[model samples]
Target: MTLRRLHSLQQWLKEKDVAYAFIQGKANLFYLTGFRCEPHERLVSLLVFQDNEPCLIAPNMETSLICQSGWNYPIIGYSDSEDPWRLISTHLSSLEIVGSNLAVEKELLSVARAEQIKALSPELALLNCEDTIMKLRLIKNDKEIAILKEAAKLADFGVEVGVHALNTGRTEMEILAMIEYELKRKGIREMSFGTLVLSGEQSANPHGKPKMKSIEKGELVLFDLGVVLEGYCSDITRTVAFGNISTEQEKIYETVLTAQEATLSLCRKGTVLGDLDRKARSIITDAGYGAYFPHRIGHGLGVEVHELPSLNENNQDQLQVGMTFTIEPGIYVPKVGGVRIEDDVLITEDGYECLTHYPKELLVVKP
Candidate 1:
């Protein structure tokens, strides 16, 4: 039931003098409630109160499923032609929430939705609760860690599939298709993020989409992919060579590898989160590829691929036990190619554990 999470949230609401909270983010809703779904144009939400039973407001179509999901709370369902806010207003008034401060996820709630909620109660003061929710979701429980470990294994298998499907003349799209097809055959329902397969000069674009261009020998191929397994997510990136590679390519690959490994070594509890990015940046800058490494070192990974505690400069948060995130450092050179080595890691009491055990050493696919 995620009761611990609810307790923490209720405590936060009490501290802020908020009557209740509207958790609108789909991912956050699933984290607190066991059920998950997307209601496109319909209103699906979880209204949590500081001192009362939480309510799950969903479409009428999902009412039976919500009841069967073992949610022993109030389930408020509305028809397509009805106004959800009206029912919500009834519930809020019953709880004496009118003219009180209510917390909402400002980062996710749309402006139109906020206006609707304001219309529901003219005197309601809406406060942003994204920071409070981020704190609640920062630490991973034992079950979450276990699910993430399994997801990481699937991610490694995905890389292996992509590496085996590589050929001298295969298009990037072809390889991407083969990788996804094989993973689906093994029960991977979805990828955490878009599957990126870039070859040769195309790899220079860190977030480039796969193209139909044929892969050639003696060039670098970057595979950045992840998978969703058991509601958890895994993300990884590995750059490999086709046939024979040049010394410059080897240098770039090695430099990124060194930077990634060095930063990973400092991923222990109590270490400043931003220092990891600075440490990796130092290595890349020393190798004269600082500008090429554009993005941050990595981000937190869990129910959603990207979560709290981003590993980048300017964030002063310290790593804590049970926190999981990625460590990806890349070197992208225009007209040449890019090299990115990423691994999911978990912070422990003593040190950090690397979850994704895919080989980071340069892999060469034969023609």
Candidate 2:
């Protein structure tokens, strides 16, 4: 699969008349080479030439791991005392790549690194290839879809653990820790993002941090989290009542749920992506909480939690089969709290499949 992905990129490079591509994004590296690593402050990159063989560069300590990851190409490992940029320049020169046009991930490359790449040769013309790569990754193959389905199942388990851990006196962080600990015991080493356990008024903050604030009766507790499995990711959000809640709170929850479901029902091949967002937004707006909704309806989910084809009010893109994304509609009313229902969705030829199916009915946990 990695070789096929690499071939696609190489074909793109050939079509554009580009000589080489310097891929530095961690996610992109994983997608193209089957090697995943947190390079940290070190430089880890894939140098792909249009006509020559590609190579991987990383810290000396990671070379073995890269090989174990099924990378069969030349790997240039650099020690801490060595200058990797200088070594990269020498390798490029050996390949007779001077004066050639190079493609790069403009969004991910840092200014200092870009300057170093520029210093390699005055005649090297750098072009942005981020869009092309994103377009390639937009549609998931059958293998990727199968992996994502497994990841989404794990995400459903995560939400289950969170719901079971809910209690009147338990702090938000306590539930958060329990959920992560359980996932870790299940062999999940990384979370797609920080697990959120926002309760009471704190939930009003769309991106609030989990706190030591105790869960109380008649409050809503929100769990927004995702797990990373085999380089793919799954995201889910569920807001449930801790105890018997106010009718106003119930209304807020139902409104968000209705909007989410309406938008999800609109998902299918050839459907206007932006209209989906509008469907949810209109529902929330009609419910008199449009001002409470701030962020986009959802984002593409795969190698990264957030990727291409953002589902926003203004986007005019159309959904295609094999495209996967999240459909999360939220309403965060200040002081009254918030409610969000999120599910990972995949567009199918006939319709769409809701990957994360942990139930959307409002669950009122007994105190």
The lDDT for every candidate, in the order shown, is 0.89, 0.91
TM-scores of the models, in the given order? 0.97, 0.98
lDDT of 2 by residue, 1-367 (tens): 9888889988888888788898999999999999998999999999987778899989999999999999999998999999999898888779855326778899988899898777866576899988988988899999999999998998999999999998878999999999999999999999999999999999999899999999999999999999999999999999999999999999999999999988988999998889988999999999999999998999999999999779998889899999999999999988999998999999999999999999889999998
Model 1 C-alpha lDDT per residue in residues 1-367, reported as the tens digit of each score: 4788888888888888887888878778878877767779888899888889999999999989877766778999999888889899887777755226878898787889988876866666899988888877889989999999999998899899889988878999999999899889999888998999999999999999999989999889999999987678899999999998999899999999999989989999989999999999999999999999999999999988999889989889899999999999999999889999999999999899999998989988889
Q: Per-prediction count of colliding residue pairs?
A: 0, 0
Give me the candidate number with maximum TM-score. 2
Clashing pairs in 2: none
Deviation (Å) of 253 in candidate 2: 0.7
